[model samples]
Target chain A: MRVSLFALILVSGITFTTAQEKDELPALDNPHNYIKLLAQDAALPALQGEEKFILRESWWSGRMEPGKAKLIQVQLFRRNAYQFWLAVPNRNGEPIINVYDSEGNLIPSESLNFEGTNIVSTMIQPEITGVYYIRVSLKTTIESPQDWAVIYAYR
Target chain B: MTRFFLFLAVSVLSSQWGLAQEAPVKIDLEDPNLVFVSDSVIPIPLEIFASLDKMGAQDWGRQIESRDIRLDANRSRTAMLFGLVVSEGFIGVQAQDKESVRRLGRDVLALARSLGVSAEVEEHANAIVNGAGRGEWEMVRQELDKTRQTVINKMKELRDDELVALVSLGGWLGGTEALASVLRDNYSAEGSDLLNQPELIKQLKLDFNGLPKRARRGDLFTQVSQTLEHLESLMRSDDTGAISEGKVIEISLATRNLVEAIYES
Candidate 1:
C-alpha cells in the first residue's frame, strides 16, 4: 500500500509539473485557501458566545503528501478549553489531527481520533499550561498534493 | 457505514468525557513520557491575557510610560522595536490611554525608518495616531494589528526572517510584561494562572534557536534568550494549576527587566 501511494504521488507530481510547463495554473492555487476558509466558517459560531475566544488571525496553511504530517506548535493555556478546527480540499485526502505534549507524549483527547472525514475538529482541556503540538496529516493518497488549513480558538 | 462509525466514535468520546469529569486530568511537568516532533508557532501572545479583565487584575502600563530608547541602526533591532511599539499600542488601547497610542504611532514610524521600511508602514502609523487623538480605540487597535502584519509581510519579502522572529519575540515579551505587572499586584489563583505559559516561552526559545547564528549572537538577543530560558524553567517547575505568589513576583521582575533590556537598549 505504501509503495502504491508513493507511486501515485510521483505520478501526480509529474502531471502537475507538466501542467506548469503548459502554462495552465495548478488545480489548487494557494493550496491552503479552501481549508483556511473552512476553519474560519467553523469558528464563526464558536465566536458567537458572550465568552470570547481570540482567533489567531494568521491561519496555518501547508501542503502535505499522503501519509505525511505537519506540526503546528501552539501554547494551550491551562484553565481554558481549546478547539482546533481543520479543513482540507475536497477529495484531496483524509485529514488526521493529533495533539502532543512538550515531551512528545500524545495527550489522550477525544479529538485525536479521525473518523474518515475531510473536516475534523479536536477539543482538549489542557491539563497544564504549556506548549502542545497539533499534528495535521493527510491519511490517504490523492492525484495531487493536498493543501490543508487549521484554525484554533481557546476560552 | 460512515454514519455507524460516527455514532460509535461519538459514544466512545462521550465515555471518555464521563471518565474525565470523574477525575481531573493531572499533568506532570517532570514526567518523562512527554514526546513530540519539531513544531511551528501560531504566535498569539497578545490575546493570551483576555481573561485579565474578568480576573480584575490591576492595569499596569508603566514599563512603557517613560523611556529614552537608544536604537542602533540595525535592521533586526528596528524590527523588534517595531513589534514592541505595536504591542504597546495594544496596551494603550486596553488602558484607554490615547496619548500613549499616539506616541507609539510615532515610535512605529521612527523604527520603520531605522529599518529602512518606513514607506510601507507610515500610512497605518499615521492612522493609528489620528485614531488615538480622536479616541477611536478600536480603530487604533485594528491599525496596530495591521501595522504589525504589514511590517512582517514586508520583512518576509525582503528575506529578513530574522527580523520576523525578533518582531514575534519582542511582541510576546511586551505582552507578557504587561500581564506579569497586572498579576503582580492582584495575585489570585486565576490571575496568577495567566503567568503560567511554559509553551510560549518554549516557542520563543525555538524561535531564537531557529535564527541564523549571525542574528542570534548579539548581546541583546543573548539577554532575551537567557531571560526566556529562565522563564521556561520557572514555568516547568510548577505543575499545579495554582501558581505561587513568589513565583509570580519572580516572573514579573524577570520579565520587566528583560523587556526593559530589549526595548530600551
Candidate 2:
C-alpha cells in the first residue's frame, strides 16, 4: 500500500512539472510572438477603410516591470495622423499607453482597449511637428516582469 | 502523503497570493526621471516625405540627385552610403523617376554587397527595380523601406550596432537635406516645423560618438561628427520649437554639405 501511494505521488509530480514546463516555455522561447499577434489584432481596424495607415516596418520592444513605464521618443510631423499600439503577452495584465508632447504635456488621443486583452493603443495628431514620447506601463497583478512591444502606423 | 499534499497546497496558495496582490501603484507623472528612456526609435525617411507631400511641396523630381557610388574599403562608409542610396530611392519614388529608381536599386545592391549582406538585400533590390518599372510607386516605397530594414536587421544580427546606427543616420541626413531644400524654396511655419528635430539630432550625435575608434578615424566620419555638432547647435538655438526660414536654410546648407562630403570623400 505504501509503495503504491509513493509511486502515484511521484507520477503526479512528474506530470505537473511537465505541464508547468510546457506553459512556461512559450513565453521564454518566443517572447515576441504573442505581443506581435496582439499588436496586429489591435491594428487591424485602422489598417482598413479609406484612410488606411501604413505600418512602419520596424517596432520597439523591451521588458517592463509593473508600475514602471518604458518611454519611446519618436518624431511626429504636423500633417500626419499616427496610431500607436502597445501589446504584451496574455500572461501580463492590460497595458497603459499614453502619448506626450515635447513639453511633457499629455496629448489627447483616440484610444483603444478591449476587456480581457493584453493590449492598449492610442492615436495622436500633433499640431506641431516635433518629438513625442510614447509611455507604456503594465497594470499587473503578477510580480514578474513582462515583455512588451510598441508598433505604430501613420496615414 | 501528507507532506506531498501540503506542498501542492502551498504552491497553489502562492500563486493565488500573487494574483491577489493587485493594488495599483501610482506613477508620478511629474517626475522627470520616472521612466528610463527605452530604445531610440528614429523616424524613417517615409514619414518626412509623406509630411512634405501633405504640405503640397512640389518639385520632388528636382530633389533627386545623381550619385556615383565610389566603393570604399571601409564598411562604415559603405553602410552610410547604403542609407544615402535608400533615401535617394525614396526621392526617386517621390519624383516617379523610373530610371533613377532602377539605378538607385542597383546602387543599393552594390552597397549591400560591400557590407557583405547582398544575399539578403538582392531580392528587395530587384523588387524595387520591378516595382519602379511597373510604376508602382507605393510598392517601390514599401520595398525601399524593406530594403533598409533588412540591411539594418542583418547588421544587428551580426552585432554591428555601429553600422546599424550609421545606416540610420545616413538615411535621416539624406531625408533632412531634401526636406530642408524643399522648405527653403517654399517656406512655411508648418512646413519648417518638420526641421525642428533637435532631439533626433542629439541622438544621432550620440550614435556617432558611440562608433568604434577605428570607424571614427575616417575623414568622412570626422566631417559627419562636426556637421552633427553644428546641426545640433542650430537646432537647439530655438526654444519655441519653431524653426525660422533662415534656420531652415542653414540646416539645408549644413546637411547638403555633409551629404556631398559623404559621396565625394
User: Candidates' lDDT values, in order?
Assistant: 0.68, 0.79
Residue runs of model 2 more than 4 Å from their true location after superposition = A1-30, B1-33, B236-241
What would the per-residue lDDT of candidate 1 be over residues B168-243, giving only the tens digit for each residue? 7788777877777777777776657667677677777878888888776678778877888889866543545667
Residue lDDT tens for model 2, B141-168: 9889888988987898899998998899
Top candidate, metric lDDT: 2
Pairs in clash, predicted candidate 1: A103-B34, A103-B35, A104-B34, A104-B35, A104-B36, A105-B35, A131-B199
Indicate which candidate wins on DockQ.
Answer: 2
Model 1, span A86-114: residue lDDT tens: 88765446676767787766676655323
In terms of lDDT, the poorest run of 10 residues in model 1 chain B is: B16-25
Model 2: how far residue B67 lies from native, Å: 1.0
For every prediction, compared with the true complex, DockQ reads 0.21, 0.21
Q: Write the per-residue lDDT of candidate 2 for residues A29-100, one digit (tens) a residue.
A: 345644655676667678889999988767888788887777788988888999888888754566888887
What DockQ score does model 2 reach against the true complex? 0.21
Error of 2 at A25 (Å): 11
